[model samples]
Target chain A: MRDIIVVAGKELREIVGAGGGRKGLVRELLFIGIFGLLFPLTQVEAWLSGGVPAAFALMVPLFLVGPHVADSFAGERERGTLETLLATRLPDRSIYFGKILAVCGYAWAVTLLIILASLLALNFGADVSGRGGSPTAGSGESEFFVYPAFVWVAWGVGSIASGLLLASIGTFVSLRSKTVRGAHQAMMIPLFVVILGGSFGIPALFRSLPPSTQERFTELLESMPAVSVVLWAVGGLFVIDLVLLGLGARLFRRDRLISD
Target chain B: MTLAVHTEGLSRRFDGVTALDGLNLAVPTGSIFGFLGPNGAGKTTTIRLLLGLLEPSSGNAVVLGRDVRRESQAIREQVGVLLDSDGLYERLTARQNLDFFARVARLSKGERDARIRALLEEIDLWDRRDDPVADFSRGMKQKLALARAFLHRPSLLFLDEPTAGLDTPAAVGLRSELVSLAREEGVTVFLTTHNLLEAERVCDRVAVIRQGKLLAEGPPEAIRGGGKRKLEVTATGIRPALVARLMNTPEVIGADVDSEGRLILALADGAETAPLIRLMVETGVEVSEARIAEASLEETFLALVDEDLNGRSRVESASGEHPR
Candidate 1:
């Protein structure tokens, strides 16, 4: 356990310090500048009231985690550090889980920062727009914007969980890939499937289903509370995370890792 | 004497091609043992097996009194390894690389800092401790890697080609340090290198392997001494007739006067040097100096490798099989 923390700490430093350290920070600031400040300013009232914040919370961390997950193991292999690390007294599981934790932890932290910045931007924008231009779209009373506690807990924690899931999948692919580029290429397959299928295939499948099946599905979804639906989604993602982690452990063999 | 490493019939084969053949060895504790082999001769493979990084096909090894197969993690904790690869994190500073490995060895905070400080200073890299390894030259990185290997002060260390990329001064310095460390600290060093001269200078016992088979194992002098003795004689008034007479002798296989007026004789097995000298004296040729030239480790290594290649070829020819 101590070894895992040490490895994770070093890995976190490396990830943040990559590209001479300043480049990563610059890129991160660029992200915050765009998504946190500019986008939130334009979406002022809708950012807090609509689903934009939730979607950004999910997708932003996932985007941040993708390259890191690919770089974790494959980067070590490319840099010739994997075999040395493997030969150490550190257990295999520590190295595996340590990298995953580092990736998820960094992405989650950045995602949360982005969300907080977005919230701040929304507050400042709401005040400016309310005083000078127009009141908040629907409500007549213009007041200080405060996101609900549930919103904080939902997106803050939920984005981390989503990052963990993506990181797990990335670990599996990275462990199998010989290079960081190879890992990224391998991860693109799953990313594409998820994006295209979620956007079009699920809806297409709904259209193909008969009226009776569609009505039953709609009734079941409607019967469940919104919180329950979120819980079910979280539960399903956790299950997938566990499966990917298990596969990753099995793939993380000394022979396979050292061979290439 | 206690043994630091013992292997019995250790072998590894990949896809019907043997990378390491059935081999047995006993390396004494606190001795600088050299493992000499050409490329693909399985030096790295042997180190990996002893470190429990790779499983053997049909044999077992004991390192630091622990079974390599079952107690690898324990063995690794107590051993240091510097493979063909330097294994340094290019992005990490020199101090960071050593500190990281020091942590892996589970040193206390004080011990880690102290050791890192002492090692960096000892290797003369403390000045550049903050520079990333990638920014360092090849020699400097090699030096830092060497320092990292000994950072934990393991009882046994496996260094593969420790001086390959080092400049002459750095190589000599590292070689001297290795010798001093082994003698003063009682650290057992298992070094593998193509530098036969370095092996001859530092190794207490050296083993030569060719095509994954152990060719020779003994002290450098012993391995070199096993072959036929060579005698160089400096005399005046020497003629072709004397050389012809010496060549026709039963014990002397070949004789020729070198450019320096020394009669170089290649003696056959079990040849007596006294009788050959007596013949030169009887021929009225004045004999000034007669000394047996000792074979060098490089010559011995070449002879052993050649012998193995010849033996394999003969077997292959007899069996009508293609040589691998």
Candidate 2:
């Protein structure tokens, strides 16, 4: 555990702390501005709604994790630092796991921070518009207009799951990539394909379903509490994460890495 | 003497291309052992196999009394390595790089701090310890890497071409530091290099390898003096008849006229030079100088490699392959 944390600490410093310097912070600020402030401000009603905000929040980890993991895994090989790392006394599992943990942790932190920022932006948007119902106005009688409790649970859990998913996929791509640029290029294509397919294919498949079946599905979904569905999704994601990390473990042997 | 590293019939083959052939060696503890080989020789492969970064194809190795196959992690805990490249983290400050490796070696926080400071000061990079490695020159980076490798105070170190590509002064400085480290700390160093001069200067023992096979292994002086006697004759106006007569002399085993009109002769044991000079004088060769001297490490290495290649060629011609 100490080895893992020590490795992760170095990684955090390299990717998000002083080692990354101003550019890393600037990238995070840009991400926060777009996802946390601008998007939420433009769609206050959608932000409160369950569906769009969940997708919106998932994007934060989806975008952040790929670069971090690709650089952390493949960059070490390309820059030749992995050789020295492998020559150390640390276990291979500790080293590999530590890298994955850092990327996921950083991405998840940024994801949660963005979610909180969006909430503030939404409430602040209300104040800016001189809306009287927001709790931020400091009157106890005023009610807070926020996303429902179920949505909060989905946003937090779903973003974490998304971060883990992206990190796993990045590890797989980085295993064969000789350079970080190659890993980045390889990661970007699949992400775009998933984004495009999820955007177009899911709706098309729903539309293709028989009208009666579609109505029954919608009815069944609406009748279930949002939190129950979220729990199920989270469970599914957790299993997938385990399987992917297992595959990574099988391939991440120290000898094999050096040979490759 | 106790052995720090021992190998018996160690070999590694990649896709039917043998990178390292069956080899046997033993390196004494607390000695600077030089692995001398040209490019494409199996020096790196041997290092990897001994370090257990590579598993052998046929035989096994024991490092620090632990089988590399079963106890590579344990071996790694007590050893340091420097590759051909510096392999430093460019974005991290020099101190951070050392700190990270020190953490891996499980040094206490206080010890790591003091060690890092002392190493930086020793390498004359203390003022720049806080600077990111990418900002430093290659020489500075190499020095910091050396510090990192020594951070845990390992009893043994594997340094692969640590002085390659450095300017003369930097190479000299690094070599001196390496000597000091080994001597002062009682460290056993396995240094690999093609720089014969560097090996000659720094190594207590050297093994010459070519085409994945060791040609010779001994102290540098023994290797230089191992073969038959050699005599160099500097003369003007030496005829081919004179060279032929000298080769036919009882004292001379083989003879050649260098491009500069000097005679290089391989001699039998205890062969006197007076007879050879007398022959040269009789053959209308004005002998200016005749001297017997020990061969340099570079000459000995080249001769060893040349002998191996020529022997291989002869075997190929006589049969289908060579066995050594």
Candidate 3:
């Protein structure tokens, strides 16, 4: 456990300090600068309302996690630090989990911070100084912006589940990739497929189904409670995470790592 | 003997091609043992096997008194390694690289700080501790790497071509420090290098390998086999007739006057030297000095490798097999 923390800590430091340190962290810093502070301030009223804006709490973190995930295994090999780290007394599991945990922890923490900053922007913006909308959006009474209780739970669970899933997939890609660029390129393939398939292929396939079947599917989705659908989605993602993580552990072998 | 590293029939094969053949070795505790070989001789493979980075195909090894297969983590905890790569994090500062590894070694706050400082100063990199490793020269990085390997004060260290990129002075300094570490601290050093002179100077015992097999293993002098030695005789009057006289004798397989007018005689296996000296004196060659020229580690290494190659060829021809 202690070794895990130590490895995780070093990994975080390296991630935070890569490229040229602060100058190299332009992307990450820009992320917090925009989403956390500026975006909320610019769209105060809509951000305060819970819907698509609230969904950013989940989507933003996963977006932020993608590139960093590639750095977990493939980056170390590219940077020539993998062999030395493997030579250490650190147990294999610790090193594996440590890197995955670091990626998740950094992305998750940033997500939470973005949420906190957004709240601060909405509640304390110049337009909302008197708890009423000012020049930022339409002039109207606006109470302190706060997420509903369910909003917090929903996005929090959603972000974590999606983050782990993406990171697990990234782990497998990174282990096989010789370069970070290669890993990222490989990761993009499935991501595009999933997004495109969900966006067009599945719907197209559904349209190809019999009209009666389409009606039946619509009826079933509509009959299911919103909370139950969310729970089912989260549960399915969790199972995929487990399977990918199990395969990742199998892939993380000392000899294979060295040979690769 | 109390062995720090022992291997029995240890071997590794890749896709039916053997990288390390069946081998046996016993490295004594608290000694600087040099593993010498040309490129592709499986020196790095042996180190990897002992460190449990790679599993052996048909045998086993014990390092630091733990079975390499079952107790690799234990062995890793007590041994330090500097492989083909320096293994330094290039983006991090020199201090940060050492500190991170020191932390991984689980040193206390106080120990980590003190050790990092001492090592930086020892390597003369304390002034540049804040500089990233990528900014340092190859020699400086190599020196820092050596310090990092010693930070935890490991009982056994496996250094593969540790000084390959260092300057002469830095290499000398590191060699002295290596001797000091092994002598005063009782640290066992398993070093592999192509530098036969360096091996001869610091290594208590050395082993030579070729084609993934052990060609010779012993003290430097021992491996420079005693049979068929060379003798150099310097005299006031040396001529072709004298060389002919020496060559005619059964003990002298070959004889010639060298650039300095010394008769260089290649003696037959375990041949007596007294008869040659008597013959030289009787020939009235006015012999001034006569001494058996000892073979250096490099010469011995080459001779052993040549013998192994020729022997392998002969065996292959006899067995009607194609030479690899």
Candidate 4:
């Protein structure tokens, strides 16, 4: 147990000390800040045109969480630190859990920033509209405010799981590859396939509906929610991460590194 | 009385090519055993097998009294290894690299600091201890690697080509340090090298390997002792008849006339030099100079390998198949 923590701590410190921590935090902050400034302008246009304000809420988590979770393992392997971590006496599960925790921590922190930025943007937009004598016309819809919370919860959970799954898969790919570029290229293929499939399936399911049916579908999509889908994705990815952790452990033979 | 490492018929195959073939070794405790082989002669393969990095395809390896494959982790804790290449984490500073491995090895904070300091000083790297290993010279990196291997003070150490890349002075320094380590700490060292002279300098016992088989195993002197002894005899105005007369002696195995027509005799017993000198003077050979030629380890090794190859070919021809 002590060995696991020692190894994990060392790995974490090395990752942080290697400049990944600072670079990632800065990139994430800048991305969120830019997106935050853009959100209110878009939201004001939506309000003036009388479209739903809640639709913009989903983009915040997607933009903030997506990049944070996606680059965790791929970046580490690219830096050549992954093999060094495995050479330690740490158990595979400890490494897997520790990395997942670190990535999730970053993801959650970014998500919180996005939420804060969006709220500030919404408040500023609302105040500007009130001063302009627009009278806050769409204030009756509490769902717009509530939807951001739901999106945060869903994105936070889904991104953590998806990030862990991708990190583990990336680690596995890195183990088989001779270089980081090779590993990154190998990981991108499967990620592209999964993203393409999700884009095609989810949108098509909502399209085949009458006007009344579309309204009912939108209500169901909001109220019934996709938390289960997020949960299922998280659960499936957690298992895959465990299995890949085992494989990465086995593939990390000391002789191979020494010989290389 | 204990054996630090023992292997019997250990063999390893990658795909279809044999890397190590039926190799056996026994290294006694408190001895520096040098493993000598040519390139691609399975030196690294043997070390990997003993370290439990590569499983033997046949037979077994028992290192520090534990089966290598079954108790690899337990054995790993007690064995330090330095491979030919730089295995240190290039991104981390020297201190960080040592500290990280020390933590993994379960050393206490105090012990870790002491060990790291001691090793860095011993390797003469204390001044550069805070620098990243990527900035280190090859010799410095090799020294750091040596320090890391000895960090745990393991009873058994496996060093593969430990001084392969060091300059002459650095190699000499490392050799002296290794010799002192064995004598003072009673550390059992298993070293593999193609440098025969280095092996002859530090090794108490050495095993010569070829094609993954032990060609010869003994002390350096014993291996070098089995070759023919040359006796260079200078006599003033010596004739063929006088040379023939001197060659008739029992101690003289054979005698030949040099280009200057001086007689050179091959002696079966180098110890018979005094008697041969007396006989030469008494026979009026007018002895001017006498010296017994010492056979070198390189010559002995070449002769042994040649004999082994020739014998194998003879056997192959008799059995109607080409030699492997």
Candidate 5:
């Protein structure tokens, strides 16, 4: 157990000190800048019905989770540090968890910065628009934007769990690949599939319903409990992540140290 | 007796081709045992198996009295390994690399700093301790590797082709350090190399392996003495009569004239050198020189490998003649 902590600490220090930490921060800043422009240009108020905060909340998962997940193991294997990591006396599970934790830490930091920037942008825009005085189309109605409390808690929990699941999957793929390009190429397939399913397939499935059926489906989605649904999805992903981590540990052969 | 490393019928095969075949090796504690073999002779495979990096197909290995497979973590904590390539993080400075490994090896903060300082000094890299390892030369990298291997002061060390690419001075320095480590610190070293001369210089005992089998194993002198012995005699004004007189000696098994007109004798008894010298001088043959031609370890190794190859072929040919 002591060895595990020592190894994990060393890995964490390497991730932070070896320029990955700085690069991740830079990436986070770039994400903020891009989203900062796109939010107002797309007139997020129209899309969200004066609920710009909810649109920003959805963007948080997309911007922070993908790069953090990809960089966790694929980046280490590219830098030849993976072999050095496996050489330590730490158990495989410890290394796996340590890497996951490091990725989650980076993702959380980035997400926090994004949330803060989004909130600042929204307030600054509102201030410039004369204290919400201009009566837009949906201005009189109460907007159901993601509240600050909900955004903080939900992003924190969802990013951590999602980052871990993706990191573990990335690690397992990295262990099986010899080159960084190969691992990254293999890892992107699943990400692409997820994006395709979320963007096109889900909306198409909803569109296939009749107008009456669609109204009923919308009512059902609105009535569903958010916490329970999020819990089920996050719990299922966490279980899958643990299994993949175990598989990664089993495949972490010491001989690959020399072969790499 | 406590053995630093012991293997019984250790075998490893890849895709039905055996890399190491039923190898049994025992390295005594505190002995610098040299594992000598040619290229593709399973030296690396044996080292990997002993270190638990490669799983043996048939047998087991015990390192420092712990099962290599079952207790690899325990064994690894007590053993230092230096493979052919220096496995290091190139982006990190020399001090950082050592300190990182030292911490993982569980050295305290103070111990880690002190050892890193001492090892940098020992390797003559104190001034460059803060420089990234990527800027270091091959020799300097090798020195750092040696330092890393001894960071935790492991009792047993496995070095695979440690000095293969080193210059003369660097090789000599590392060899001296290794010898001193075994003699002074009582650290048992398992070294594998193709350089017979280097092995002859530093190793107390060597095992010559070929085709995944042990051909000959002993001290250099014992192996050199085991092969056929030759005697050379130089004489001025030696006639046929002088040659006949030398041949009449019971110890002279056969005699031949060389291209230089000097007589060479094959001795049946190596212990009769004194009598032969006396006989040559007393016969008025003006004996200028008399010395036994000592066989070298290389010669012994070649002879053994050649013999084994010939034996295998003969067996194959004979088996072909059988009905089955």
Candidate 6:
């Protein structure tokens, strides 16, 4: 556990901390500002109800994790550090798990922070618009504005699960890729497939369903609470995350990692 | 003396190409043993195998009293390695890189701090410890990598071409440090290099390898003195007849005139040079100078590698296949 954390700590510093330099920090801040402030401010109702905001949120990890996770193994190899890492006394599992955990943890933190900031921004905008009926206001009582407990919890868990899933996939790609650019290129297709398929393909398929079938599906969705669906999705993504991590571990051969 | 490493018939093959073949060696504890080989002569492969980063194709060996095939991790824990690559994290500061490896080595926080400081100071990099490694020069990076390898103070060290890229001063400095490290710390070092002079000066024992085969293994003097000593006499009155007579004599293995018209005699083992000089003088040759010198390691190494190449070429031509 200590070894894993030590490795993760170094990795986090490299990807997000002072080691990332001014350009990296500025790029990350820009990304956060655009997604967490601009997008949410432009679509206050949809951000609260969850449609375009949710899709944008999911897309955030894909873009952020793509560069960070690709650098996990492939970057080390390119920089001639992987062999030394392998030669260390740290267990193979520590190095593998440490990199995955670090990348996922960073992506997860950024995603959650964006979501919270967007929520706060939306609420502040509402209050400024005089929609939040404050008791001090001459008009009556200002309604307290908050996303339901279920929505916050569901989004938190689901966002983390989604980050882990994508990061794990990126880990596998990075482990096999000879260069960081190669890993990034390899991840693009699968990432786009997941983003486009989950957003447009699956929903379009549901729309194409027979009216009776669509009604039954709506009934099923209605029968299940939103929290339950969120939990189910998070749980499913977590399982896939585990499988991808396992596959990554299995493929992390020291010889193969260093050899061409 | 206790053996630090022992290998018998340890070999490795990559696809159809043999990288190491029938390597048998025993390195004494606390000795600086040099593994001399050319670029493609499998020095790195041998180190990887001994470190258990590689499995042998047909044979096995023991390192630090444990089987390399089964107890590689145990061996690794007790050994330090510096390969051809300087494995330093570029983005991390020098202190951070050492800290990370020290953590992996499971050093206590107190010990880690002390060791990192001491090593950095010793290598003269303490002032720049906080600087990113990417900002370092190649020699500086190499020095840091060397420091990292011994940061844990392992009982055995494997250094592959440790001084390959450094300028003369840096190489000499590092070499002296290595000598002191071995002597003071009692660490057995297995260093590989093609620098014959460096091996002669720094290594207690040396092994010459070519084409994945062991050519010779012994102390520097012994390897240099392996064959007959040659005596060169700078005389103005040498005769062709005397040269022929010297070549036929049992004491003289061969005789020839060098490009400078000096008498070069390949004397048999334990042959006296005084008698040869007297005989030359009696034969009306003015012996201005007579010098007997042992063959240098460079000469021996070149001769062995050339012989191996010639033998390979012969076999390849007969089989109609070029050797890799």
DockQ of each: 0.57, 0.67, 0.61, 0.22, 0.26, 0.53
Taken in order, the candidates have interface RMSDs of 1.2, 1.6, 1.2, 4.6, 3.5, 2.0
Candidate 4 structure quality by residue, lDDT tens digits, B1-324: 788988888998887888888776778888999887778878878887887766788988899999987877677778877876556767578998899788878899999999999889877889988887878988888888888888888888888889977899989998998898889999999998878888889998777777777777767777666657878877786766766776787888888877975566777854477877887787677777777886677776776667777764111111122222
Error of 2 at B154 (Å): 0.6
lDDT of 1 by residue, B255-316 (tens): 77779878899899878899989988998989899998766788777777778878841111
Q: Estimate each model's TM-score.
A: 0.89, 0.91, 0.86, 0.74, 0.77, 0.89
**Ranking according to TM-score, highest score first:** 2, 6, 1, 3, 5, 4
Per-residue CA lDDT of model 5 for A187-257, tens digit only, reads 77766665566568769998998999999977876786655555555577578777877777776667654
Share of the reference A-B contacts seen in candidate 1: 0.53
Write down the worst ten-residue block by lDDT for model 3 chain A.
Answer: A131-140
Per-prediction fnat values?
Answer: 0.53, 0.68, 0.69, 0.22, 0.29, 0.54
For residues A189-213, could you state the per-residue lDDT of candidate 2 as single tens digits? 7677656665797789999999999
Order by lDDT, highest first? 1, 2, 3, 6, 5, 4
lDDT of 1 by residue, A1-260 (tens): 88889898888878887876467588788888898899988877667663577667666777888888898988888888887888888988889888888888888788778888886887665554443232234454545555544345446666777787788888878887888889999988766665566569879999899999999998998998555665666677678788888888777777567654
Worst 10 residues of 6 chain B by lDDT: B314-323
Q: Sort all candidates by DockQ, best to worst.
A: 2, 3, 1, 6, 5, 4
Evaluated at residue B244, the lDDT of candidate 2 is 81
Deviating ranges (above 4 Å) for candidate 4: A13-147, A154-156, A201-220, A225-260, B167-169, B231-290, B311-324
Chain B TM-score for the candidates in order: 0.87, 0.91, 0.88, 0.82, 0.82, 0.89
Deviation in Å, model 5, residue B176 alpha carbon: 2.2
Task: Give the higher-TM-score candidate: 1 or 4.
Answer: 1
Docking class of 2: medium
**Clash pairs detected, candidate 1:** none
